[model samples]
Target chain A: MRFRRWILPGILVIALAITGVWGYNQYKIKKNYETTMQNSYQRMFYDLKDHVENVQVSLSKVLLADSQEQNVILLSQIMQQAYLAEEKLAQLPISHKDTAKTEKFLNQVSDYSYALASNVLEGSPMDQDQKDALLKLQNYTDYLSQELMGVHNKLTEGVFNIGEIKRKEKEDIENANDNMLNVRLVKLEDKMTKSPELIYDGPFSDQVLSGKAKGLGDKKVDIEEAKKIAQEFTGAENTESIEVIEEGEQMDKTAWIPSYTFSIPKESSPEDSPIYIGVSKTGGKVVWMENSRAVNKPKISVEQAIEKGQKYLVEKGYESMESNYSLQYDGLVLINFAYKQNDVTIYTDLIKVKVALDTGDIVGMDAAQYLKAHHDRNIRQPELTQSEARGKVKTDFDVDSARLAIIPKEGAKEYLCYEFKGTYQGGDFIVYVDAITGKEVKILKIIKDENGTLTF
Target chain B: MKKAVLILSMAMLVTLSATGYYLYINNQNQNNFSSTTEGINSVEVSNAEKNKDGVEESETVNATLAPKVLYWGSTGQDVKDVQWKLAQWDYYNGAVDGIYGTETYRAVRAFQSKNGLGVDGVVGPETAAALGLNFGPVDGGTQGAGTTAISRNDDIYLLARAVHAEARGEPYIGKVAVAAVILNRVENPSFPNTIASVIYQPLAFTAVADGQINLSPDADSLKAARDAINGWDPTYGCRYYWNPATSTSKWIWSRQVVIKYGKHWFGN
Candidate 1:
């Protein structure tokens, strides 16, 4: 009797203890779930807001393009993004009726924006009415973006306690360590220094530093080592002397980077181990360095690269020749050439590249490669007379002007062509025709409708 | 015998009391959980409503609702097919994914921008979108989902095309937006405008910023195009649109709202 009594008491105590533990665990689980859910929702909201911002940016581009083609393409893209953003927002399943209503409003805004773009591209006539509508649409989208920004800020500040729906989610946090926003811009004062046509100007040069590189490692440049390496490459005094002008960071927390400026002899070339060496400041190791490959004998000069580009085309039989127009992109030179064949004048662009003046080596050639790779193409000469070609223009089009020029065709031939531009059929049209054969070669049409006016 | 019975009854009473306590706590927890879930749903709904309030004014502003039907190109047939194709790519924003709506127009523009097409936002020949290629025609098993279908290589090509289309005709910023538009379409439902679909829409993007979509896209273009598509978007909610030159589009005035970015305005 005593044993039975004791066993029953013990069982009662155990059961109570188990219940208490279970209750605590449940509380903890619920709390955890709430946190995760809240976080995920907030992030999703921010993502949606960001997407809306992107749509505004795209539409802005359409408004700014100068070419008819650019405007059309940009308009199309704006409409696409606007609707997509609306759909994304709609999928959130936010239970608040007010929020759903707001989403619907945004959707309507997107629809309006898309409609304008479509009408404009369709050659619809543009009047003050359309302009006024576009202005309103533009303003509304901006307001929406601003409003969303406000919401995002509030969420970030914990203004809304979405604690019940909290849940953990994997996030792709941008590693703050991977920033090199301290790069600076410097002019290459020395002619012998040889600046590359394509410069790797890091984000730092533009002052677009977001300070996102928290806990980032120092720049990946070994100042002392890079100076030493630079001396060897430039044949400077002491073969290790370098003046550090600036320092920077790159690839997150991995390295320290620095930029140096110096004056080397005019005869210095990339013939040595390295003319210039970029090193990692953190580890005092080299990350990048240039070698002697850029240096060659009188193998190719800037002028020679241009000549070669032209000659390459000539070898393929393109005649009516001229010269390179100008140089750009640091070391890139644009060559303009003309040739006459079969009573026609052909104009073409030839691009030539010289890595550095100090090395006199050709680094790239374009026009020649293009001509060689693409053989003379067969083309059907237009058969319409100038009058007939002009007649093909719509009646509403008004003739602005006309010109006669020699045009080059792909078959190593030239043709006398007439270029006519006018407003026809209530739209602008630019037409090209063969003067000798009186055939229509090309036609560009620009339409003006309620949506807007297009210019070619 | 009486004392033993008393002890047994007392034990039974204790057991009953403990069981009752356990049940009470369990019921309380369930109630809390259900209440919290309801609260979460309510919160989400409220937040969404708050988000949409800003664009409410523009829809009724000029309100010149035109015919919804669109003539995408000369024959209109290409636009129809392209719209359906875009639907497959998940860019369809309307009923058939084929019926061109305001959303479809936006997606077409984004595609043009990605493929170096003209910024006219139309699916004209010069803005020839990319043509779908059969990788299998050259090598079997070389292309598949997540493997060859619009992979990094294609991204680069599309990016280059966007650069050509947007940057060539407009300022560099416009080109970036053009790039962003393509990227936006990749995430939007109104466009057949997957990063790949919009790019390969076939003659839909001819004036790629370079006035030639025929230019072989470079690796940088592909990557940038993809990045723009995946990264920062410029057309999130904006549906109606206009460039400054075409600011006179009456349809735009019909839209009372405005969302500004860089140099253009997007909204109804």
Candidate 2:
């Protein structure tokens, strides 16, 4: 009793209340963590369902499309959908071993569609076997979409329990979303593996594995020279007054370039916004530049904006650059251009030009990709004649125009191929027939999305 | 009734032990001179002094943290650590493979030559301190823990990632500028106070929207993040930056740009 003056019931009550409150606080923290984790899992499941639906819908659209442009668009949409679905699927409780086939299926869909779309973008035609494969893919996606929607419906109905699903995982029993997932996803993936094997020298091919910027040569320029090149590249009137901000051979160990960065003073507001330009140390060319300022008001149409962008490119000596696509974002219309050499388009040399709708002036232009990839490519003569290449395309393709073109293989290498633009099964496609082997190398289904013409 | 009394006594014992522990910690904190700078260790100092080989101990040791000097022909994590910091600052151009090769030695010499360390190409503790690697685990006591030092590991990682994503290809200073902007925004009234909040704010950074923020931070980005947190405001309180060459946001143009570092122009 001497240990506590208030060794009474009141003291005991106080201590008990404190412990109770502290315990409650701890419990609340635990609850919050659990709820947040479950919510994330729920959100991921919902997103996966949506992406799978999109993949199915895109496949269906591909089946419906009759134009090569629409096929290109559809395939890209499918690729994006497949990638998103794969990402969401990985975030779920399902084991990686259980989902490996599904993941590989998604990967191939994205990679194959991308290769095919690139083939078309370079003006190739799709063969019948590719179309057949696409049709088969469409069927499996249909099955997946419906099954995924059904599972989502069950999730909405509280048919699956999150806690129970986790508990079942301990016993190595299939639970949570596994049954609903494996039932359809595994079958769909299995079907995907049996489809026609597409062997193309796309960016993903092992043969195309190289990270070196082969186009960037040994010529080096100092900062002062780089600054001059920068001012001209940025179209700045005052060359000397433009502040040289930073100069370096490489930004980091991984980056492969020496460049000088410069700042251009604003006319009205010296500090309002900053404009910077990067001139490459090699070949004294502009590598990267950016100008950020809000547009005033919408005054110019997209047509005029395109014209202005092209005009700017032409004036800046981006000779033979053709406007390939346009994307509208915020208040600006960004036009993507590809360089053409000797009547054959080089898709690797891409430049983006952004035109403000309000002023019809070129507000943004990023030539980093172009400068890194562009070089005087000695495009080889195709081993196969246009007619011979056409013969190797999907036998059912209504072959249109075939031409000799060189396209980038894996961003590091170039391959000359015969580009054939045509339609198959009332759906438009471009299938590239390898110039050397007379084999159907790549196929593309084209579609036009909201922003502009894009290939997967 | 006996059980009730026993429970009460146990609770009393717990409360008394808690109070004693609290007081012990509080007393230990007050005993230290200050954490922001080095405090003279009063315990067994004469013995420490005797072991220094006639070298006098520096007064401010806690303020600076640097691992043991890494030398050429030495291959370990420490060498890779300093090499990364050097690479981030544009002093080193070779891969951070942890082997202190000739390139790494040259980089160490350059970094030392610039930082006023001995130009002998050896990465002594002094140079390591400049590189921001810790000499040892910093005490998180009640004394001033140094405002420049970050406490949370995740904050350092997030800040470093933001730097890498936002200014990966920019010059070393540009990476610093990007990190500084985040810190500056943390202080600015209009922006969020936390690094994660300021960085993840919708439309604040293009890297977040583009998912480039997920890229792992290189050594330079990590160092830039550390430098920014350590009160290195290379952007000088500028709140915004964008490459005028690629950004179509005419709205951002209205802000006054203080200066340009690398490809980015910092604006207020």
- Candidate 1 lDDT tens digits, A234-344: 346774335342221222221112223222222355323223233333433322222223222233455665566556545434444544232322222233443334433
Best candidate, lDDT-wise? 2
Interface RMSD of each: 25.0, 24.5
Candidate 2 reaches a DockQ of: 0.02
Candidate 2: what's its TM-score on chain B?
Answer: 0.48
DockQ of each: 0.01, 0.02
- For candidate 1 chain A, which ten residues in a row score worst on lDDT? A179-188
Q: List residue ranges in candidate 1 displaced over 4 A.
A: A1-4, A92-97, A119-128, A163-456, B1-268
lDDT of 1 by residue, B1-268 (tens): 7567557756765675566566556555445544433332332221110000001111111111111223453233335555654554555545543445677777777766666756565554333324232111111244322122111223444456556644444422234346665544343323322344444322223342113454444323432343243222233223333465644334345543333333554442
Best by DockQ: 2
Residue A21 C-alpha lDDT in model 2: 64
Residue B68's lDDT within candidate 2 is: 46
- TM-scores, all models, native as reference: 0.26, 0.42
User: lDDT tens digits, residues B18-51, model 2?
Assistant: 7555554444332221220011112112111100
Question: Comparing to the true complex, what docking class would candidate 2 get?
Answer: incorrect
